[model samples]
Target chain A: MVKSYVEYTFKNSLPPNATVLLAAPTLPIQAEGGIPGNKGIWAGILSEMTEFALLFGVYFIARAHFPQAFKEGPLRLSLFAGTFNTVLMISGSYFVANAVLAIRQNRPRASVRWLILVLIAACGYLLTKYFEFRWNVGQGITGKTGIFFTVYYYLTFTHMVHVLWGIMGLLWVIARTRMGAYTPAEHEGMEAFASYWHATDLIWLVIFPLLYLLR
Target chain B: MKAMTHKRTIGLLWLLLVALTLGGAFLGETAAPGLAVTVIVSLTMAFKGRMVIDHFMELKTANRTIRSLMRAYFYVVPLVTVLVYLFGDRLARLTTL
Candidate 1:
Protein backbone atom coordinates (compact mmCIF):
# COMPACT_ATOMS: atom_id res chain seq x y z
CA MET A 1 0.00 0.00 0.00
CA VAL A 2 2.73 2.45 1.00
CA LYS A 3 4.73 1.43 -2.03
CA SER A 4 1.84 2.37 -4.26
CA TYR A 5 1.54 5.75 -2.60
CA VAL A 6 5.22 6.49 -3.16
CA GLU A 7 5.10 5.22 -6.69
CA TYR A 8 2.09 7.40 -7.47
CA THR A 9 3.95 10.41 -6.19
CA PHE A 10 7.19 9.88 -8.09
CA LYS A 11 6.28 7.69 -11.02
CA ASN A 12 7.28 10.32 -13.52
CA SER A 13 10.04 11.88 -11.48
CA LEU A 14 13.76 11.29 -11.95
CA PRO A 15 15.45 8.80 -9.69
CA PRO A 16 16.83 10.36 -6.51
CA ASN A 17 20.39 10.00 -7.85
CA ALA A 18 19.58 11.95 -10.98
CA THR A 19 18.36 14.98 -9.06
CA VAL A 20 20.58 17.75 -7.73
CA LEU A 21 19.07 17.69 -4.28
CA LEU A 22 20.92 14.39 -3.82
CA ALA A 23 23.84 15.10 -6.10
CA ALA A 24 26.96 17.25 -6.11
CA PRO A 25 26.38 20.99 -5.92
CA THR A 26 28.07 21.23 -9.32
CA LEU A 27 24.57 20.57 -10.62
CA PRO A 28 22.16 22.99 -8.98
CA ILE A 29 18.88 21.39 -8.18
CA GLN A 30 16.01 22.95 -10.01
CA ALA A 31 13.36 23.48 -7.42
CA GLU A 32 11.37 20.32 -6.94
CA GLY A 33 7.52 20.06 -6.53
CA GLY A 34 7.37 22.09 -9.79
CA ILE A 35 9.16 24.81 -11.68
CA PRO A 36 10.90 27.49 -9.56
CA GLY A 37 7.93 29.62 -8.50
CA ASN A 38 5.42 27.53 -6.53
CA LYS A 39 7.54 24.80 -5.05
CA GLY A 40 7.89 22.97 -1.78
CA ILE A 41 10.90 25.15 -1.01
CA TRP A 42 8.71 28.26 -0.99
CA ALA A 43 6.22 26.53 1.27
CA GLY A 44 9.08 25.58 3.61
CA ILE A 45 10.40 29.13 3.62
CA LEU A 46 6.95 30.51 4.38
CA SER A 47 6.41 28.13 7.24
CA GLU A 48 9.70 29.11 8.85
CA MET A 49 9.51 32.86 8.21
CA THR A 50 5.93 33.27 9.36
CA GLU A 51 6.61 31.51 12.62
CA PHE A 52 9.78 33.51 13.25
CA ALA A 53 7.95 36.80 12.55
CA LEU A 54 5.14 36.03 14.94
CA LEU A 55 7.59 34.93 17.62
CA PHE A 56 9.73 38.02 17.13
CA GLY A 57 6.69 40.30 17.32
CA VAL A 58 5.67 38.81 20.62
CA TYR A 59 9.16 38.98 22.03
CA PHE A 60 10.44 42.34 20.80
CA ILE A 61 7.19 44.27 21.17
CA ALA A 62 4.50 42.38 23.03
CA ARG A 63 6.59 41.02 25.85
CA ALA A 64 10.35 41.70 26.13
CA HIS A 65 10.27 45.34 27.19
CA PHE A 66 6.96 45.56 28.95
CA PRO A 67 8.85 47.77 31.38
CA GLN A 68 10.33 44.77 33.17
CA ALA A 69 6.93 44.14 34.73
CA PHE A 70 7.75 40.54 35.61
CA LYS A 71 10.98 39.13 36.79
CA GLU A 72 12.07 35.52 36.72
CA GLY A 73 10.55 34.21 39.92
CA PRO A 74 13.36 31.79 40.63
CA LEU A 75 16.34 30.15 38.97
CA ARG A 76 14.33 27.00 39.59
CA LEU A 77 14.25 25.69 36.02
CA SER A 78 16.81 22.91 35.72
CA LEU A 79 19.59 23.98 33.40
CA PHE A 80 19.90 20.28 32.85
CA ALA A 81 16.55 20.25 31.08
CA GLY A 82 17.57 22.92 28.64
CA THR A 83 20.89 21.29 28.09
CA PHE A 84 19.42 17.86 27.51
CA ASN A 85 16.89 19.28 25.12
CA THR A 86 19.53 21.08 23.13
CA VAL A 87 21.71 18.03 22.84
CA LEU A 88 18.80 15.88 21.78
CA MET A 89 17.69 18.28 19.10
CA ILE A 90 21.18 18.70 17.75
CA SER A 91 21.77 15.00 17.63
CA GLY A 92 18.43 14.41 15.95
CA SER A 93 19.10 17.16 13.49
CA TYR A 94 22.33 15.47 12.53
CA PHE A 95 20.44 12.33 11.70
CA VAL A 96 17.85 14.08 9.61
CA ALA A 97 20.48 16.19 7.92
CA ASN A 98 22.53 13.11 7.13
CA ALA A 99 19.45 11.37 5.94
CA VAL A 100 19.17 14.17 3.44
CA LEU A 101 22.70 13.57 2.24
CA ALA A 102 22.27 9.83 2.35
CA ILE A 103 19.30 10.03 0.08
CA ARG A 104 21.45 12.10 -2.22
CA GLN A 105 24.15 9.44 -2.21
CA ASN A 106 21.55 6.78 -2.93
CA ARG A 107 22.46 5.22 0.34
CA PRO A 108 19.22 3.70 1.58
CA ARG A 109 20.74 2.01 4.59
CA ALA A 110 22.63 5.07 5.68
CA SER A 111 19.51 7.22 5.36
CA VAL A 112 17.57 4.75 7.47
CA ARG A 113 20.26 4.79 10.09
CA TRP A 114 20.21 8.56 10.28
CA LEU A 115 16.41 8.76 10.42
CA ILE A 116 16.24 6.21 13.21
CA LEU A 117 18.62 8.38 15.20
CA VAL A 118 16.34 11.37 14.59
CA LEU A 119 13.35 9.55 16.07
CA ILE A 120 15.38 8.38 19.02
CA ALA A 121 16.37 11.92 19.79
CA ALA A 122 12.81 13.12 19.36
CA CYS A 123 11.62 10.59 21.90
CA GLY A 124 14.34 11.66 24.29
CA TYR A 125 13.30 15.31 23.91
CA LEU A 126 9.71 14.50 24.92
CA LEU A 127 10.82 12.51 27.91
CA THR A 128 13.10 15.21 29.26
CA LYS A 129 10.52 17.93 28.66
CA TYR A 130 7.94 15.90 30.51
CA PHE A 131 10.17 15.63 33.52
CA GLU A 132 11.06 19.29 33.34
CA PHE A 133 7.40 20.27 33.24
CA ARG A 134 6.69 18.01 36.17
CA TRP A 135 9.46 19.62 38.18
CA ASN A 136 8.28 23.13 37.34
CA VAL A 137 4.74 22.28 38.38
CA GLY A 138 6.05 20.76 41.58
CA GLN A 139 7.78 24.06 42.38
CA GLY A 140 4.39 25.87 42.17
CA ILE A 141 5.44 28.23 39.41
CA THR A 142 2.29 28.68 37.42
CA GLY A 143 2.21 30.02 33.89
CA LYS A 144 0.91 33.09 35.70
CA THR A 145 4.24 34.29 37.11
CA GLY A 146 3.73 37.70 35.59
CA ILE A 147 4.80 38.26 31.99
CA PHE A 148 8.20 36.63 31.96
CA PHE A 149 7.12 33.27 33.23
CA THR A 150 3.93 33.53 31.23
CA VAL A 151 5.86 34.08 28.05
CA TYR A 152 8.48 31.63 29.16
CA TYR A 153 6.13 28.73 29.55
CA TYR A 154 4.10 29.76 26.55
CA LEU A 155 7.06 30.04 24.18
CA THR A 156 9.03 26.98 25.29
CA PHE A 157 5.97 24.78 25.60
CA THR A 158 4.63 25.94 22.26
CA HIS A 159 7.99 25.20 20.70
CA MET A 160 7.97 21.79 22.33
CA VAL A 161 4.62 21.08 20.73
CA HIS A 162 6.11 21.88 17.35
CA VAL A 163 9.05 19.61 18.08
CA LEU A 164 6.59 16.85 18.93
CA TRP A 165 4.84 17.35 15.60
CA GLY A 166 8.22 17.23 13.92
CA ILE A 167 8.77 13.88 15.57
CA MET A 168 5.69 12.56 13.83
CA GLY A 169 6.95 13.87 10.53
CA LEU A 170 10.29 12.19 11.07
CA LEU A 171 8.46 8.98 11.81
CA TRP A 172 6.94 9.18 8.37
CA VAL A 173 10.42 9.66 7.03
CA ILE A 174 11.42 6.58 8.92
CA ALA A 175 8.52 4.65 7.44
CA ARG A 176 9.51 5.76 3.98
CA THR A 177 13.06 4.80 4.72
CA ARG A 178 11.90 1.34 5.69
CA MET A 179 9.87 1.02 2.54
CA GLY A 180 12.81 2.05 0.36
CA ALA A 181 10.56 4.76 -0.93
CA TYR A 182 12.91 7.63 -1.63
CA THR A 183 15.17 7.76 -4.64
CA PRO A 184 17.95 10.32 -4.76
CA ALA A 185 16.02 13.03 -6.59
CA GLU A 186 12.63 12.66 -4.98
CA HIS A 187 13.87 12.77 -1.43
CA GLU A 188 12.59 16.33 -1.39
CA GLY A 189 10.00 15.28 1.15
CA MET A 190 12.78 14.12 3.41
CA GLU A 191 14.80 17.25 2.71
CA ALA A 192 11.82 19.50 3.24
CA PHE A 193 10.96 17.75 6.48
CA ALA A 194 14.56 17.90 7.68
CA SER A 195 14.39 21.62 7.04
CA TYR A 196 11.32 21.77 9.27
CA TRP A 197 12.94 19.72 12.01
CA HIS A 198 15.91 22.04 12.02
CA ALA A 199 13.61 25.05 12.12
CA THR A 200 11.88 23.69 15.21
CA ASP A 201 15.27 23.14 16.80
CA LEU A 202 16.20 26.66 15.77
CA ILE A 203 13.31 28.08 17.79
CA TRP A 204 14.77 26.52 20.89
CA LEU A 205 17.95 28.37 20.02
CA VAL A 206 16.17 31.62 20.79
CA ILE A 207 14.10 30.20 23.60
CA PHE A 208 17.20 29.11 25.46
CA PRO A 209 18.60 32.59 25.29
CA LEU A 210 15.40 34.53 25.81
CA LEU A 211 14.09 32.45 28.69
CA TYR A 212 17.03 30.86 30.40
CA LEU A 213 19.99 32.98 29.47
CA LEU A 214 18.51 36.45 28.91
CA ARG A 215 17.23 36.32 32.45
CA MET B 1 35.94 16.77 -0.04
CA LYS B 2 34.90 17.00 3.60
CA ALA B 3 32.78 13.82 3.13
CA MET B 4 30.30 15.17 5.74
CA THR B 5 31.39 13.78 9.07
CA HIS B 6 27.89 13.49 10.55
CA LYS B 7 28.47 11.50 13.74
CA ARG B 8 31.60 13.39 14.63
CA THR B 9 29.67 16.62 14.37
CA ILE B 10 26.98 15.26 16.66
CA GLY B 11 29.63 14.33 19.20
CA LEU B 12 31.05 17.83 19.15
CA LEU B 13 27.62 19.37 19.66
CA TRP B 14 27.03 17.14 22.66
CA LEU B 15 30.29 18.34 24.17
CA LEU B 16 29.36 21.97 23.61
CA LEU B 17 25.93 21.45 25.13
CA VAL B 18 27.47 19.87 28.21
CA ALA B 19 29.87 22.77 28.47
CA LEU B 20 26.94 25.13 28.30
CA THR B 21 25.03 23.22 30.97
CA LEU B 22 27.93 23.11 33.34
CA GLY B 23 28.90 26.68 32.61
CA GLY B 24 25.42 27.90 33.45
CA ALA B 25 25.25 25.78 36.59
CA PHE B 26 28.73 26.70 37.80
CA LEU B 27 27.91 30.32 37.39
CA GLY B 28 25.04 29.53 39.72
CA GLU B 29 22.81 32.24 41.11
CA THR B 30 24.19 35.73 40.92
CA ALA B 31 23.58 38.89 42.88
CA ALA B 32 23.25 40.90 39.70
CA PRO B 33 20.60 38.92 37.90
CA GLY B 34 20.73 41.07 34.76
CA LEU B 35 24.48 41.37 34.53
CA ALA B 36 25.44 38.10 36.14
CA VAL B 37 25.99 34.50 35.13
CA THR B 38 22.72 34.46 33.28
CA VAL B 39 24.06 36.99 30.82
CA ILE B 40 27.06 34.86 30.01
CA VAL B 41 24.92 31.78 29.83
CA SER B 42 22.49 33.46 27.45
CA LEU B 43 25.26 34.63 25.20
CA THR B 44 26.70 31.15 25.06
CA MET B 45 23.25 29.78 24.36
CA ALA B 46 23.02 32.17 21.45
CA PHE B 47 26.32 30.89 20.16
CA LYS B 48 25.17 27.32 20.48
CA GLY B 49 22.01 28.19 18.63
CA ARG B 50 24.01 29.70 15.82
CA MET B 51 26.12 26.58 15.55
CA VAL B 52 23.04 24.40 15.37
CA ILE B 53 21.66 26.51 12.56
CA ASP B 54 24.87 26.85 10.66
CA HIS B 55 26.53 23.46 10.90
CA PHE B 56 24.10 20.90 12.25
CA MET B 57 21.08 22.20 10.40
CA GLU B 58 23.25 23.08 7.43
CA LEU B 59 21.48 26.35 6.81
CA LYS B 60 24.75 27.33 5.17
CA THR B 61 24.21 24.71 2.50
CA ALA B 62 20.70 25.90 1.79
CA ASN B 63 19.72 27.49 -1.51
CA ARG B 64 19.64 31.29 -1.75
CA THR B 65 15.97 31.55 -0.91
CA ILE B 66 16.44 29.30 2.06
CA ARG B 67 19.65 31.09 2.98
CA SER B 68 17.88 34.47 3.06
CA LEU B 69 15.15 32.98 5.16
CA MET B 70 17.83 31.79 7.56
CA ARG B 71 19.35 35.26 7.70
CA ALA B 72 15.88 36.54 8.34
CA TYR B 73 16.09 34.50 11.53
CA PHE B 74 18.52 37.12 12.85
CA TYR B 75 15.84 39.77 12.55
CA VAL B 76 14.90 38.97 16.13
CA VAL B 77 18.31 40.00 17.46
CA PRO B 78 17.72 43.66 16.71
CA LEU B 79 14.23 43.35 18.05
CA VAL B 80 15.82 42.51 21.35
CA THR B 81 16.72 46.17 21.56
CA VAL B 82 13.44 47.22 20.04
CA LEU B 83 11.66 45.56 22.88
CA VAL B 84 13.41 48.12 25.01
CA TYR B 85 12.54 50.95 22.69
CA LEU B 86 8.90 50.10 22.26
CA PHE B 87 8.40 49.36 25.91
CA GLY B 88 10.11 52.46 27.32
CA ASP B 89 6.88 54.24 28.22
CA ARG B 90 5.27 50.93 29.03
CA LEU B 91 8.07 50.19 31.47
CA ALA B 92 7.48 53.52 33.16
CA ARG B 93 3.76 52.76 33.13
CA LEU B 94 4.32 49.08 33.83
CA THR B 95 2.49 49.24 37.12
CA THR B 96 -0.76 49.81 35.25
CA LEU B 97 -0.26 46.67 33.13
Candidate 2:
Protein backbone atom coordinates (compact mmCIF):
# COMPACT_ATOMS: atom_id res chain seq x y z
CA MET A 1 0.00 0.00 0.00
CA VAL A 2 2.73 2.44 0.95
CA LYS A 3 4.72 1.49 -2.09
CA SER A 4 1.82 2.16 -4.38
CA TYR A 5 1.13 5.50 -2.79
CA VAL A 6 4.76 6.55 -3.03
CA GLU A 7 5.02 5.40 -6.60
CA TYR A 8 1.80 7.07 -7.59
CA THR A 9 2.77 10.38 -6.09
CA PHE A 10 6.37 10.51 -7.26
CA LYS A 11 6.49 8.54 -10.46
CA ASN A 12 5.91 11.62 -12.53
CA SER A 13 7.01 14.39 -10.21
CA LEU A 14 10.34 13.09 -8.91
CA PRO A 15 13.48 12.33 -10.79
CA PRO A 16 15.23 8.99 -10.56
CA ASN A 17 17.74 10.21 -8.00
CA ALA A 18 14.98 11.49 -5.75
CA THR A 19 13.25 8.15 -5.99
CA VAL A 20 16.42 6.45 -4.87
CA LEU A 21 16.75 8.90 -2.01
CA LEU A 22 13.19 8.25 -1.03
CA ALA A 23 13.89 4.53 -0.99
CA ALA A 24 17.12 4.94 0.87
CA PRO A 25 17.49 2.65 3.85
CA THR A 26 18.83 5.40 6.07
CA LEU A 27 15.42 7.11 6.08
CA PRO A 28 12.05 6.04 7.33
CA ILE A 29 10.08 6.10 4.13
CA GLN A 30 6.89 4.97 5.80
CA ALA A 31 6.98 7.82 8.27
CA GLU A 32 7.57 10.59 5.70
CA GLY A 33 4.09 10.59 4.12
CA GLY A 34 5.78 10.97 0.71
CA ILE A 35 8.85 13.04 1.40
CA PRO A 36 7.51 16.57 1.49
CA GLY A 37 11.03 17.75 1.05
CA ASN A 38 13.45 15.10 2.25
CA LYS A 39 14.04 12.71 5.09
CA GLY A 40 16.61 14.66 7.10
CA ILE A 41 14.41 17.72 7.48
CA TRP A 42 11.45 15.61 8.55
CA ALA A 43 13.71 13.99 11.12
CA GLY A 44 14.64 17.43 12.37
CA ILE A 45 10.96 18.36 12.62
CA LEU A 46 10.24 15.22 14.62
CA SER A 47 13.03 16.06 17.01
CA GLU A 48 11.85 19.65 17.28
CA MET A 49 8.32 18.52 18.10
CA THR A 50 9.66 16.08 20.69
CA GLU A 51 11.64 18.81 22.41
CA PHE A 52 8.64 21.15 22.48
CA ALA A 53 6.43 18.36 23.80
CA LEU A 54 8.70 17.90 26.76
CA LEU A 55 8.83 21.62 27.34
CA PHE A 56 5.05 21.82 27.18
CA GLY A 57 4.86 18.95 29.65
CA VAL A 58 6.93 20.96 32.07
CA TYR A 59 4.71 23.97 31.40
CA PHE A 60 1.55 22.04 32.14
CA ILE A 61 3.07 20.66 35.29
CA ALA A 62 4.05 24.11 36.44
CA ARG A 63 0.69 25.58 35.54
CA ALA A 64 -0.99 22.84 37.49
CA HIS A 65 1.03 23.52 40.59
CA PHE A 66 0.70 27.27 40.25
CA PRO A 67 -2.65 27.71 38.59
CA GLN A 68 -3.19 31.09 40.12
CA ALA A 69 0.13 32.33 38.92
CA PHE A 70 -0.61 31.10 35.42
CA LYS A 71 -3.99 32.72 35.59
CA GLU A 72 -2.69 36.08 36.65
CA GLY A 73 0.44 35.96 34.53
CA PRO A 74 -1.15 36.53 31.13
CA LEU A 75 -3.06 39.54 32.35
CA ARG A 76 0.20 41.40 32.69
CA LEU A 77 1.38 40.48 29.22
CA SER A 78 0.87 42.74 26.22
CA LEU A 79 -1.90 41.08 24.28
CA PHE A 80 -1.39 43.53 21.44
CA ALA A 81 2.19 42.43 21.05
CA GLY A 82 1.23 38.78 21.21
CA THR A 83 -1.57 39.20 18.70
CA PHE A 84 0.58 41.22 16.33
CA ASN A 85 3.28 38.63 16.45
CA THR A 86 0.72 35.92 15.80
CA VAL A 87 -0.46 37.75 12.69
CA LEU A 88 3.10 38.19 11.47
CA MET A 89 3.95 34.53 12.03
CA ILE A 90 0.82 33.28 10.37
CA SER A 91 1.37 35.64 7.45
CA GLY A 92 4.95 34.47 7.14
CA SER A 93 3.84 30.88 7.10
CA TYR A 94 1.31 31.71 4.41
CA PHE A 95 3.96 33.31 2.24
CA VAL A 96 6.26 30.38 2.71
CA ALA A 97 3.48 27.98 1.81
CA ASN A 98 2.68 29.98 -1.29
CA ALA A 99 6.34 30.00 -2.19
CA VAL A 100 6.35 26.22 -2.09
CA LEU A 101 3.20 26.10 -4.12
CA ALA A 102 4.63 28.53 -6.65
CA ILE A 103 7.72 26.44 -7.07
CA ARG A 104 5.65 23.32 -7.50
CA GLN A 105 3.83 25.19 -10.24
CA ASN A 106 7.17 25.83 -12.00
CA ARG A 107 7.27 29.53 -11.27
CA PRO A 108 10.64 30.22 -9.70
CA ARG A 109 10.27 33.99 -9.92
CA ALA A 110 6.91 33.83 -8.19
CA SER A 111 8.46 31.58 -5.58
CA VAL A 112 11.21 34.11 -4.95
CA ARG A 113 8.68 36.90 -4.57
CA TRP A 114 6.74 34.85 -2.06
CA LEU A 115 9.95 34.21 -0.18
CA ILE A 116 10.66 37.93 -0.10
CA LEU A 117 7.27 38.38 1.52
CA VAL A 118 8.24 35.72 4.01
CA LEU A 119 11.41 37.62 4.87
CA ILE A 120 9.42 40.79 5.36
CA ALA A 121 7.00 39.05 7.67
CA ALA A 122 9.83 37.35 9.54
CA CYS A 123 11.57 40.65 10.08
CA GLY A 124 8.30 42.09 11.27
CA TYR A 125 7.97 39.33 13.83
CA LEU A 126 11.51 39.83 15.10
CA LEU A 127 11.06 43.56 15.40
CA THR A 128 7.74 43.19 17.17
CA LYS A 129 9.26 40.63 19.50
CA TYR A 130 12.23 42.87 20.32
CA PHE A 131 9.91 45.69 21.32
CA GLU A 132 7.70 43.28 23.18
CA PHE A 133 10.67 42.09 25.19
CA ARG A 134 11.74 45.64 25.88
CA TRP A 135 8.26 46.48 27.10
CA ASN A 136 8.22 43.31 29.19
CA VAL A 137 11.48 44.18 30.89
CA GLY A 138 10.43 47.81 31.23
CA GLN A 139 7.45 46.56 33.18
CA GLY A 140 9.74 44.48 35.39
CA ILE A 141 8.45 41.19 34.07
CA THR A 142 11.76 39.42 33.87
CA GLY A 143 12.29 35.71 34.15
CA LYS A 144 13.47 36.11 37.72
CA THR A 145 10.20 37.79 38.67
CA GLY A 146 8.38 34.53 39.32
CA ILE A 147 7.67 31.00 38.07
CA PHE A 148 5.14 32.22 35.51
CA PHE A 149 7.55 34.70 34.03
CA THR A 150 10.25 32.05 34.06
CA VAL A 151 8.15 29.62 32.06
CA TYR A 152 6.99 32.40 29.78
CA TYR A 153 10.55 33.43 29.02
CA TYR A 154 11.71 29.85 28.57
CA LEU A 155 9.04 28.89 26.02
CA THR A 156 8.94 32.14 24.06
CA PHE A 157 12.70 32.50 23.96
CA THR A 158 13.18 28.94 22.75
CA HIS A 159 10.59 29.58 20.05
CA MET A 160 12.32 32.83 19.12
CA VAL A 161 15.58 30.96 18.68
CA HIS A 162 13.84 28.52 16.35
CA VAL A 163 12.38 31.43 14.40
CA LEU A 164 15.82 32.93 14.06
CA TRP A 165 17.07 29.66 12.67
CA GLY A 166 14.18 29.63 10.25
CA ILE A 167 15.00 33.15 9.15
CA MET A 168 18.52 32.02 8.38
CA GLY A 169 17.15 29.07 6.47
CA LEU A 170 14.97 31.42 4.44
CA LEU A 171 17.98 33.55 3.59
CA TRP A 172 19.94 30.55 2.41
CA VAL A 173 17.08 29.18 0.36
CA ILE A 174 16.34 32.59 -1.06
CA ALA A 175 19.90 32.98 -2.22
CA ARG A 176 19.87 29.61 -3.90
CA THR A 177 16.45 30.27 -5.31
CA ARG A 178 17.57 33.49 -6.96
CA MET A 179 20.45 31.61 -8.49
CA GLY A 180 17.90 29.29 -10.10
CA ALA A 181 18.94 26.26 -8.12
CA TYR A 182 15.40 24.96 -7.74
CA THR A 183 12.68 23.98 -10.19
CA PRO A 184 9.13 22.89 -9.86
CA ALA A 185 10.07 19.25 -10.05
CA GLU A 186 12.90 19.45 -7.52
CA HIS A 187 12.59 22.10 -4.85
CA GLU A 188 13.29 20.21 -1.69
CA GLY A 189 14.98 23.16 -0.04
CA MET A 190 11.87 25.30 -0.46
CA GLU A 191 9.60 22.60 0.91
CA ALA A 192 11.96 21.95 3.79
CA PHE A 193 11.99 25.61 4.73
CA ALA A 194 8.22 25.77 4.45
CA SER A 195 7.87 22.79 6.75
CA TYR A 196 10.15 24.34 9.35
CA TRP A 197 8.40 27.70 9.23
CA HIS A 198 4.96 26.11 9.46
CA ALA A 199 6.06 24.03 12.40
CA THR A 200 7.36 27.11 14.15
CA ASP A 201 4.15 28.96 13.40
CA LEU A 202 2.13 26.07 14.78
CA ILE A 203 4.19 26.13 17.96
CA TRP A 204 3.55 29.83 18.40
CA LEU A 205 -0.16 29.32 17.83
CA VAL A 206 -0.14 27.20 20.94
CA ILE A 207 2.18 29.45 22.90
CA PHE A 208 0.26 32.66 22.20
CA PRO A 209 -2.77 31.55 24.14
CA LEU A 210 -0.87 29.77 26.84
CA LEU A 211 1.23 32.81 27.64
CA TYR A 212 -0.85 35.73 26.47
CA LEU A 213 -4.56 35.00 26.28
CA LEU A 214 -5.36 32.38 28.91
CA ARG A 215 -5.81 34.74 31.77
CA MET B 1 -4.24 23.04 -13.93
CA LYS B 2 -4.13 21.44 -10.53
CA ALA B 3 -1.78 24.12 -9.23
CA MET B 4 -4.45 26.75 -9.70
CA THR B 5 -6.81 24.77 -7.55
CA HIS B 6 -4.10 24.35 -4.92
CA LYS B 7 -3.45 28.07 -4.91
CA ARG B 8 -7.11 28.84 -4.40
CA THR B 9 -7.25 26.33 -1.62
CA ILE B 10 -4.22 27.90 0.02
CA GLY B 11 -5.72 31.35 -0.27
CA LEU B 12 -8.95 30.18 1.31
CA LEU B 13 -7.04 28.42 4.07
CA TRP B 14 -5.04 31.55 4.76
CA LEU B 15 -8.21 33.56 5.09
CA LEU B 16 -9.65 30.98 7.44
CA LEU B 17 -6.52 31.14 9.57
CA VAL B 18 -6.66 34.90 9.77
CA ALA B 19 -10.31 34.77 10.76
CA LEU B 20 -9.62 32.21 13.44
CA THR B 21 -6.75 34.20 14.87
CA LEU B 22 -8.76 37.39 15.05
CA GLY B 23 -11.82 35.60 16.40
CA GLY B 24 -9.68 33.91 18.99
CA ALA B 25 -8.23 37.24 20.06
CA PHE B 26 -11.74 38.64 20.49
CA LEU B 27 -12.89 35.61 22.37
CA GLY B 28 -9.84 35.79 24.59
CA GLU B 29 -10.75 39.30 25.54
CA THR B 30 -14.53 39.09 25.97
CA ALA B 31 -15.26 35.53 26.96
CA ALA B 32 -16.16 35.98 30.58
CA PRO B 33 -16.61 32.33 31.49
CA GLY B 34 -13.29 30.58 31.97
CA LEU B 35 -14.08 27.02 31.01
CA ALA B 36 -15.92 28.05 27.86
CA VAL B 37 -13.00 30.17 26.84
CA THR B 38 -10.56 27.36 27.43
CA VAL B 39 -12.58 24.86 25.45
CA ILE B 40 -13.08 27.21 22.53
CA VAL B 41 -9.46 28.26 22.50
CA SER B 42 -8.36 24.65 22.66
CA LEU B 43 -10.58 23.69 19.75
CA THR B 44 -9.34 26.64 17.74
CA MET B 45 -5.76 25.67 18.44
CA ALA B 46 -6.37 22.13 17.25
CA PHE B 47 -8.18 23.35 14.14
CA LYS B 48 -5.46 25.79 13.20
CA GLY B 49 -2.79 23.20 13.70
CA ARG B 50 -4.66 20.75 11.52
CA MET B 51 -5.04 23.33 8.76
CA VAL B 52 -1.33 24.03 8.81
CA ILE B 53 -0.47 20.37 8.77
CA ASP B 54 -2.93 19.36 6.10
CA HIS B 55 -2.77 22.37 3.79
CA PHE B 56 0.33 24.46 4.46
CA MET B 57 2.45 21.39 4.97
CA GLU B 58 0.82 19.69 1.98
CA LEU B 59 0.09 16.55 3.92
CA LYS B 60 -3.49 16.27 2.81
CA THR B 61 -2.57 13.61 0.29
CA ALA B 62 0.43 12.21 2.05
CA ASN B 63 1.01 8.56 2.65
CA ARG B 64 -1.26 6.90 5.18
CA THR B 65 1.27 6.41 7.95
CA ILE B 66 2.73 9.89 7.68
CA ARG B 67 -0.68 11.50 7.49
CA SER B 68 -1.86 9.56 10.50
CA LEU B 69 1.19 10.55 12.53
CA MET B 70 0.89 14.24 11.70
CA ARG B 71 -2.83 14.16 12.38
CA ALA B 72 -2.21 12.49 15.71
CA TYR B 73 0.41 15.06 16.62
CA PHE B 74 -1.89 17.98 15.87
CA TYR B 75 -4.86 16.42 17.63
CA VAL B 76 -3.19 14.90 20.67
CA VAL B 77 -1.00 17.83 21.68
CA PRO B 78 -3.82 20.35 22.00
CA LEU B 79 -6.24 17.83 23.44
CA VAL B 80 -3.78 16.81 26.09
CA THR B 81 -2.90 20.41 26.84
CA VAL B 82 -6.57 21.23 27.36
CA LEU B 83 -6.99 18.20 29.54
CA VAL B 84 -4.01 19.20 31.58
CA TYR B 85 -5.25 22.74 31.80
CA LEU B 86 -8.59 21.59 33.13
CA PHE B 87 -7.36 18.79 35.38
CA GLY B 88 -3.83 19.79 36.16
CA ASP B 89 -4.40 19.75 39.87
CA ARG B 90 -5.71 16.23 39.82
CA LEU B 91 -2.95 15.18 37.42
CA ALA B 92 -0.22 16.64 39.60
CA ARG B 93 -1.60 14.97 42.65
CA LEU B 94 -2.07 11.67 40.89
CA THR B 95 1.48 11.70 39.64
CA THR B 96 3.03 12.74 42.94
CA LEU B 97 4.86 9.54 43.74
Query: In terms of DockQ, which candidate is strongest?
Result: 2
Q: What's chain A's TM-score in each predicted model?
A: 0.76, 0.84
How much TM-score does chain B earn in each model?
A: 0.58, 0.86
Q: Report per-candidate DockQ.
A: 0.25, 0.40
TM-score, cand. 1: 0.72
Identify the candidate with maximal lDDT: 2
lDDT of 2 by residue, A1-215 (tens): 99999979868787768867766544211134476777788888878888888888888888888888988898788888888899888889889888887776678899899999999999999899899999999999899988999999999999999999999999999999999999866788878888889889989988987888775
Could you tell me every candidate's TM-score relative to the true structure? 0.72, 0.87
Residue pair clashes in candidate 1: A16-A183, A16-A184, A16-A185, A17-A184, A22-A104, A67-B91
Which candidate wins on TM-score?
2
Write one digit per residue (lDDT tens) for candidate 1, span A1-215. 99998977775576756556545544222333222222564586467657765765565454435535433533657767876787677667666767777777789898988888888889899999889888888987678856666766777777887887788878887888779888876776776687788777777766665555444
Please give the clash total of every predicted structure, in order: 6, 0
Provide the overall lDDT of each model, using Cα atoms, as 2-decimal numbers: 0.64, 0.83
> For residues B1-97, could you state the per-residue lDDT of candidate 1 as single tens digits?
3344554665577577657655664554444555444445545655665676666555555456655556555544534433444454564455335
lDDT by residue for model 2 over B1-97, one digit each (tens)? Answer: 5556667877898888888888888887777738778878888888988988888887776666556777787788778767887788898897677
